[model samples]
Target: MAAPSAARSLLLCVMVTAFLHHLQLQIPPVATAAAASPNKTDGRDDGRGKTFSLTLYQHETINKTAYMVVDGVTGAGVSQTTTPFGTIYVFRDDLTVSADRASRVAGVAEGSSITTSLDGLQSLSLAKITLHGHRGHRGSVSVLGGTYNTKPSDYPVVGGTGDFAYALGYVRSSPLDLRGRTVTYKMELHLYWPPYAHYAPVPHKPV
Candidate 1:
């Protein structure tokens, strides 16, 4: 009788322990992460109408004369290709486009298109950009033709492929230095792209 009584008491204690454990599991003591975090939203648009700035360094090669029509005066298909080394900035973020001499052509300009399309325009260009690692359209940058040197040029950012699919904006190019046959230019590109705005191909338009 004594042994049975002891056994029953032990069983009661065990059952009580299990009941307490079950109660603790039903009401966990941990606080939710969301509730503990500060209440603040990310301060950026959802990629629509977003603007970016690129500070590009262009080295007009010694071969620019080869594409010159009248030795840098004017001619059809007179285009110059420059290799660039610089940084692209988005607010405070920065990325390097300069690379292991892969010899990326920063941009191309044709004097003939400028001369024929726009009347009597001196110091102009039919600017088409192509940068390595640039979000250009289908492996090419849609043409951006305009007078990009009128007291510091502001050329349109027509259309692009890759990340710049329906890209729109302008590029302001200012001369940084002139070295004999190699000129250096600093181009500030202000870019904007919108959703569903890309893929809408347009006819050739002069700006």
Candidate 2:
């Protein structure tokens, strides 16, 4: 008996996504200022301010020239490998975020993500995201990290640069389209930033 095409496709997607997740975990995490101090961002589960959501529509293109193919996780390749680190995949994205569906693009996100295979199904991933807004006065923010198994389905927002300095939170993404080589992702972000620059301290309410 043979499996259905849709089911097979979905299964393959899941397997590939899982493999990519595993690949992401292998990348060494860069130590951020926020990460260095455990006391500051104490609770990874707890963050400040209201939970704001951003609808991020992402488009990626994969090819061999985007990234230098390395021999292993840490090796810096002198020459390009035929495959995307043996997977024939490397993509750069100029994603846009919106407040509404098909509305004017609010912000521009620029970054590149790579997928590498260790051996067989074993794989790795590396992604870097930087965000900038046109209408806002506040500075931009960036998210840098590796993902594994795609489980937890969410990764920390880590820290940011500019007016949004010291920002920390988490992000989760869902696939909107899977067109074999190309994929579209709808990413939802939950960010925690420092309190208002000039705001009154809250007096405790009568209990």
Candidate 3:
């Protein structure tokens, strides 16, 4: 009787050990680690990317930075009164760090605005903003959208080059001064780069 009981006990212990070994084989090390730390394997980690922002001032003056290249049927040059529909204006305005024109030049805002509305209060604008050593970044961002004369307007950043490669975001333009001959606009830019297009600083080539 004692021998039979010892044999049964040994058999039970062997069965339990085999069952645990089977479980160990079923769960992989990678899966176990992922389950232990939920944050690392979740979908939220994939969406992470880089972002950048900037604020610059654009000064527009008649026959200077702003000009009417294509005149509508109403007149030949920029209209002092209400601008006629179909009129087009081109600008290569200086972007400054501050509202003062004497401030450090950050870049240039080159684009065109076409009068879309009969009231001349709104226009379709397309612009390319080039940055020069502003915040240690050098690149150009392209923007296009409708610009309202009275209120602030938002333009989508469609593409970019150089340091701003694969950039995506928007620009908010607000008019600071419009009463005088020189109109000052405050441009607030919000830029983003995808995870794949990581921002790698370009090496300076000696001129």
Model 1, position 73, has a per-residue lDDT of 29
Residue range 61-173, candidate 1, lDDT tens digits = 44442232232223323223221111110111111244222345544432233233222323335445555444442222344444432235666666665555666766665
Query: How do all models score by TM-score?
Result: 0.45, 0.46, 0.68
The model with the greatest TM-score is 3
lDDT of 3 by residue, 130-192 (tens): 998787778899999988876788888888887877877678888888877888989987765
Model 3 residue runs over 4 Å out of place are 1-49, 74-82, 196-207
Candidate 3 pairs with clashing backbones:
none
- How do these models rank on TM-score, best leading? 3, 2, 1
Task: Write the residue-wise lDDT of candidate 2 on 23-45 in tens digits.
Answer: 99997776443244333322233
lDDT of 2: 0.46
- Candidate 1 Cα outliers beyond 4 Å, as residue runs: 1-49, 62-66, 70-121, 134-140, 143-145, 148-150, 195-207
Residue pairs with clashing backbones, model 1: 136-161, 136-162, 137-161, 137-162
After aligning candidate 3 to the native by TM-score, how far in Å is the CA of 125 from where it should be? 0.6
Model 3 lDDT at residue 86: 79
TM-score of 1: 0.45
